[model samples]
Target: MTTWSAPIYVYLWLAGMAGGSYFAAFLAERFAGYNQRRLTQLAIQMGVLPAVLGVLLLLADLGNPLRFWHLLAEFNILSPMSMGTWILLAWVAIAVVMNVLYRYEGQHGEPGGRPIHRLNGGLGWLQFLFSILLMSYTGVLLATSNRALWAGSALIPPLFVASAVSTGIAVLIAYILVVAPVTTGKTTEYRLPARLLTGSTEWAIPTRLVGRLWEAEAIVILVELVVLIGLVAWLGSSAMAGAREALNMLTFGALAAPFWVGVVLLASIVPLAFDMMSPGKELARREVFRVALASSVCVLLGALFLRAVIVIGGQL
Candidate 1:
């Protein structure tokens, strides 16, 4: 049996989850209506938890969590880990401020409820910027390592971004399905704020939002697949046979089943099919909800698997 270290897996999982959740919140806030405040709040709460935990896991792996403070005291932009730590701190700070603003606005309730609209707008833009940083840092963290398999791959950052976006969509879909039903009793016509989350309503979603999100996810997944295939092919052609063999393990070895079946087919392809089907105006609400939920779960699993395979392959 191959002995796996729990700390490494924990780091990978937490980073992906944190990155994915932030990306999801950022996107929903940009495109969705009235629900932006709620979604932003959710993003802050959800994103912070994973980030904090992931950092702790990384510290634990070092065997002395207190030593982590030393890294903060010393500033080194050239170091990928150091850069990532700074970025994470910025992201957390911005997210917290945004969440607080969102809460304050929610409490007042009106066009003139709060006077921080301009500040909120600025914070929203800052949130998006930090989100991109957080998403890309995961790939940078791995790529900077001396490991041959992880280094020299410029595709890693984009791949991480794509995975983050795909996973974000999945999280949004799941959130909507679970929470949208409760809003049926709300008499007010839902209007999503500029920085809040939104969902399909009255048993039907706006065609534009649903269609756009699905299309974006499809493109991201396809691009990710292409990158993975190209990377494998390149590795095979190189003199590093060990690296090539390790990459192949992802396709034909123990990780093959999850990579091919769970991540590729079930997560990307199946969801694409459902999106393409467009069950129509007459489709049952329950059926639509089920499809969305299932696709979300698959995407989440795929995101997790991507990091898992990479981390394991590096070890091999």
Candidate 2:
């Protein structure tokens, strides 16, 4: 019997999240004019681990793990798997180069670093493009399958992209909160009364960008929320029985608890509510970071749950 296991789901989640991280970091550093140093550093760090880990997981999941090397030897422009392998290989090389160049400039304090940095920045565009393709390829890989649940709708790729971005922002936010220093006396801190009606008493007020980062996270989360709604709606309306079954599994089947509580409630809504608590205004930086950290954790967990549910539910 054919089966997709936990490792496959993990590979999918990691690949998407990594692609999202690279794309998010690239955009922030390139066009948004954010803290290029920090963003680039985060990008390279985030990209490398996932790129390596995803491949490892993929290999382990294969029945014949050693056969993985054949991917490089094989060349089929028409094969999604073959193309994805090439993209993955290229992406890893770019990530390593970025990491090396960034660290070199930092250690040597090279005055000529400007031109080198510029060249590296130019490569960032390639990273972004590869990221987009890599993220979409996950959905395309599944959709090309004969499985009705996977092939029923054209929205999977876009949905995956949105989710990838949302999770990517979460990962970046967590990294920033952990690594970046807190600004002292930068803004006044204030707290609203806790929602007694809702049960919890903790209050949160968001402060904008420790420089320009958090704001971007909020924007991506919002976009993901919108795309998520469309994804569900599209899937629900799909004429295929497998699609309906898959949707049912998510909404009211064995996977319901994890899908709703883990993915929908904790992952999507909670973070969204936290971000909306204070938008574009400066408040307590620590408090904002705390809330953002909480959101990031939830988003990451939710992202993992999403892949598990989709992979398993589709088959059922």
Candidate 3:
């Protein structure tokens, strides 16, 4: 298999993040009641912006942004490239639709009800389906390759999916902490006590919402941790000599710093620890914010570091 450039790895990672963010938001929208609409809407809003950036980066990587449509001009079911191209295109379209409908709901609809659009259910399913495909595609793109480290690896898809979702949650947490406080718009029916907004309380958003998202993120990180270890063990036990060597590189070799410090310590363990200790009905907001900020920064950095290790290690 040909070595992919840094842009390719980033493209795959960012695309997964974009999709995963929408997936997390979509679930919030679907299951949570209408009162939490603000949170869900904000989370939903996170998807399109990153997706647009990821697409633009991909176009730039192709050397001529205009020629991107050529990718859509073919349909090769047997090719991972073809599958990814169409999946992202469709995922972007679905995200745009979801955003448009959400905005419309915000502007001209009953304040205390779920989105009234008739196609909402169908559109949501598409969003959910495509997000899963997009997240899985990132890892599949690598695994289907002939590279010894990735060829027979069965865990990359699940690993990437879990990590993508956790990072998506991190993005939501970071954004809400920094941006939601200053916003004056009353777009949803959800209301916070004056204490929460006035800095007297321990929370920025409601306790239930914050608790659920943190819990979800922590759970996904644990799953990712398990998958990561399993991937390492799989590589260690591989028949191919290169695969075993790749495992060593991740554990105690050239790539060890990023793998251990960046991914294991910062990304998984540190964030997981913070998340598991999530405050209950009362705690200092700054304390929670600090922990969240640290976790978010760590997860985002760890994600990039992980892909770097995987991509560069595969080549080595």
Per lDDT, the best of the predicted structures is 3
Better of 1 and 2 by TM-score: 2
What local distance difference test score does each model get? Answer: 0.65, 0.71, 0.72
Give candidate 2's error at residue 103 in angstroms.
Answer: 1.9
Candidate 1 residues 1-316, lDDT tens each?
A: 3233556655656665666666665575566764434555555656777777877777887766778888789779878788888887887777677667665665566576457656777787777777787788878877776555667457667777777777766665565555543334523122233233222222323334543555566677777778777667766766653666666777798778877886678756777786665544112255665766676787778777777777666667
TM-score of each: 0.80, 0.85, 0.85
Candidate 2, which segments miss by more than 4 Å at Cα? Answer: 182-212, 280-284
Query: How much does candidate 3 score in TM-score?
Result: 0.85
Clashing pairs in 3: none
The Cα error of candidate 3 at residue 244, in Å, is 0.9
What would the per-residue lDDT of candidate 3 be over residues 181-232, giving only the tens digit for each residue? 4333532122333232222322235545655776787788899999999998
The regions of model 3 sitting more than 4 angstroms off are 34-36, 63-66, 111-116, 182-205, 279-284
List candidate 1 segments past 4 Å from native. Answer: 1-6, 24-41, 109-114, 183-211, 279-284
**On a 0 to 100 scale, what is the lDDT of residue 132 in model 1?**
81
